[model samples]
Target chain A: MGIVATSFRDELLAAGLLVPLGADGLYGRAAAFEDVVDALARLIVSLGAADGAARIRFPPIEPRSVFDRTDYLRSFPDLTGAVVTFRGDDAGHARLLAAADTGDDWTELLEPADAMLCPAVCHPLYPTLTGTLPAGGATYDLQGWCFRHEPSVDPARMQAFRQHEIVYVGDAAGARAHRDRWVERGTELLADLGLDVEAVVANDPFFGRVGRMLATNQRDQELKIELVVTVASADQPTAVVSSNCHEDHFGAAFGINTAEGDVAHSACVGFGLERVTLALLRRHGLDVERWPSTVRDRLWP
Target chain B: MTDDVIRAVLAEHGRLAVDVAALDPDADLYQVGLTSHASVNVMLALEDSFDFEFPEQMLRKRTFESIAAIRAVVDGLTRAEVD
Candidate 1:
């Protein structure tokens, strides 16, 4: 399937999602669009931070072992492009160059002996809450620059994106409630922002043989919902936010048990901060005050 | 699981959603929408909901075929645990 990209990059640039990183695509400064990003992040976290959920922060890069244990590696291994330490002397580089000169792929040189990828969301963080002891469950207000090697360049589905999630672990009822409540609450919040959005059954982009079964189970369970908005196109709305309830998988793996006794089930309300900003820009003009009166009223100081 | 259950279980991948059980047992899992990534997800879900760890040797392909096949594996593991 091919995407009708249709100036999506230009639209986001016009909307202040990008700044000229340079001719090389390695780096570009983020626009002051962050002013809005910070606000959006705050709003999402605040909504998720309710009910006995104590907040925690974690380093951006979670370990490979951690991911492997969670089956995150099994599910979306393709998305995992990682950082590696090359203690190679100059001779090693020369050998790699020679191999490349023979018109072979670059896989030979880029092997990472020890490595990690920035997580897609708070998936890595959920499992870590295991060992911590708490009177109640722990809730985290988390934000990170997550990286995924997605083939879609829809501007909404960026290769590198910002995600903020409110993660909760402990109490199965609380976990399901967190996921169930947010499905309604999140849609209302987005509606208040003045964007017409769709909530649909969605699932993780698991790869390979197991992906089919996973997708079926996902649709069967209706475990995920995509909050979508039509930014540049009416037919193809972008998913700006999501809510997921990951029963007790992470709690069991992390050994995060409840104070009341039992395996802790967990849930997360994850927002693609950048995706929401783009949706906002698509609905209203880039100028803050020029947006719909309702939105402006909600956003104003 | 019965044919209806199998078809429903395999259908969410979009291809097999119609009548996976009608197909022959040897039909490739990928042909029926059991993508490699989704396969891992299904495995994780099985482990989670059933509270059973997957066997290491059975982690290879050719295992996740028809609904009956999955049930056989799940049952064998289940029966073993119960015993």
Candidate 2:
């Protein structure tokens, strides 16, 4: 790691914001960090409460069948984490114990579970809404701990992280408008919280050669926007929030229709709680008490 | 020569859904399915083929939106090199 990343990690560890789990991409959040995360979540909900979105929370794991239907494995096979269990007989268990005693790999005895870790917060929402919508449409506010298989030491990119998303499921215009509105709102919210943030046109990390085309198409169409803040490096800012427009992709896939029987277009604005908290720590020093009074008031008061 | 070189590079490395020969030079490559990831490949191929690095400003979507746009950037970079 470079000087900046190394120092940042040291500062976080010293301040109790991050508790090292002796594993890459895994860290336990201390009270101060969790407080910031919870405060941000409350702030987000307060900002979006008027939208009348049906709030739903989901577990970190989702059905494998539902995940397959979303085509996430096809697009991001490298980042999908499948949940597995030990389905061994007593003899097999004895061998597994022996392997554990010898510190050998016991993963061979594990079997794939019915579910995989949730890749995106919105993945489980579509299948549940698989039908015609009301006249105008429906909106959802979902938050959960989402898991991805990318293991990295970068504090900003965690293998297990929390995501809060306000998803719009409706007509094309409504969905587009919802995304646009949140883009502005999110920028203002971050700014008000005393963080420098910019919303830029961006693309998802698509897989393989064909995925390259998908990323370009996404950018060209302005289908995705990211709220970026300078965390570890000013030159390479990290994206803490993302606003995406799915544009009937999910509607068509899940058979969700509008009142007129047309496929519903969808959009979502997602905030990575840990990334936001890290951004706050990066902007204002690690000491919560020493942060700007206004930021402190917003988060604590 | 530059146009032919651009076409050849894209054909060899673009991983495009459609034939490079069939694409309109001015048409939006992204609209036709040139992905952002593939665009990076196209950029690298152009840089290797022409022996020049693209400036940071030239890395946006507009710089590679079409075959014509890519040709323009390459021409400008090569011209700058010669001058």
Candidate 3:
């Protein structure tokens, strides 16, 4: 098997921006890459600063109990990741070691962990937000590491990534307004950074037979929209930012209520840090210093 | 007959808190406690009972909004089968 260096991912690896692990979708970031990601995160915060969104951060893995309440497993079982750990005794451990020595399937010996990798940044916050809200509702500035099990060589799609999200939980009108505003703002922000960007109606990759209907329904209602940019190819653009209106889905799931005694509607705008960085690199070049003056000033200045 | 089957399917798979039989044909199922997650179950069950697959065009929320909507869609698909 010969690995070619013609791909964008290969170029990143060659330029020392991304350090590849043994896996297809997993990688370590070099200092230069980390700096770009950090700058992007800061830019996101600055853009949303006027909104007064309360900042919150959580670890990548959330409790399985909370994960069970979400519809992720039902809709996206293909992308869901469940944490498992070894809980075996001495005999079991010895067997596991023996299997490891012989290169057998030792993962079967592991037990289900109490945690699962969070698929979205806003998911874990819903549990804390159960109960009624105040007058105008709440807005949160959240950033976290999110996980999905989709392994691909696209480099844009990673198993592990960071999301900087602005989440609003309130009435239906407020939620939709939040999503709509963000759709415009997010597109402008990305476009200003020197990328060819567009906001388009999009749907989640819902799973299975019934999921097809759900995807169509979602698109019909315009519940989700994404700001996409060409990262890998001209034909296929990646979603660098997305605005979604959950429309009481999370409120119903987590029992969150509004000031008006109705189930609260939730919306979020998530910016993919790594994807945007990659988009910038693809648009400009791997050398950050050599980037267009406008782009450099927007990020570093 | 189609309405009865839709009702029975709703009773079994809708997981709704309300009684499906008592609701009006135009009632919004989602407002009556039917969730998006449960709606998938309802959609699959409806497919099983009708023995017809829903094309992408007919898979909107309006198709499953009420008993009448479900009945209409089912009738159209099965009638197409007869044709």
Instruction: Identify the candidate with maximal TM-score.
Output: 3
How do all the candidates rank in terms of TM-score, highest first? Answer: 3, 2, 1
Q: Pick the DockQ winner.
A: 3
Chain B TM, cand. 3: 0.94
- Write candidate 3's Cα lDDT for A1-301 as tens digits: 0122138889999999988898988999999899889999998888777677888898898999889887788889999888999997999999999999999999988999999999998888999999999878899999999999998888888999999999999999999999999988888888889998888999999987668877877887789999999888767788999999987788888999999998999999999999999999999999988999988898888
| lDDT string, candidate 1, B1-83, tens digits | 43444445455432333466467755666555564445655566566655787776566445565556766777788789999
DockQ of candidate 2 against the true complex: 0.15
Which prediction has more favorable TM-score, 2 or 3? 3
Error of 2 at A102 (Å): 2.5
- Expressed as tens digits, the lDDT of each residue in B1-83 for candidate 2 is 77788888778876666888888899887666565555767877887888888876676678888889988888888899999
- Compared with the true structure, what per-residue lDDT tens digits does model 2 show for residues A263-293? 8899999999999999999998888779999
The weakest ten consecutive residues by lDDT in model 3 chain B span: B30-39
Q: Score chain A of each prediction against the true chain A by TM-score and list the results.
A: 0.86, 0.97, 0.97
Instruction: Give the worst 10-residue stretch by lDDT in candidate 2 chain A.
Output: A208-217
The parts of candidate 1 lying over 4 Å away from their true place are A1-4, A14-16, A20-32, A93-107, A132-136, B1-83
Alpha-carbon shift of residue A104 in model 3 (angstroms): 0.3
User: Where does model 3 exceed 4 Å of error?
Assistant: A1-6, B8-35, B47-58, B76-83
Q: What DockQ does each listed candidate score?
A: 0.09, 0.15, 0.48
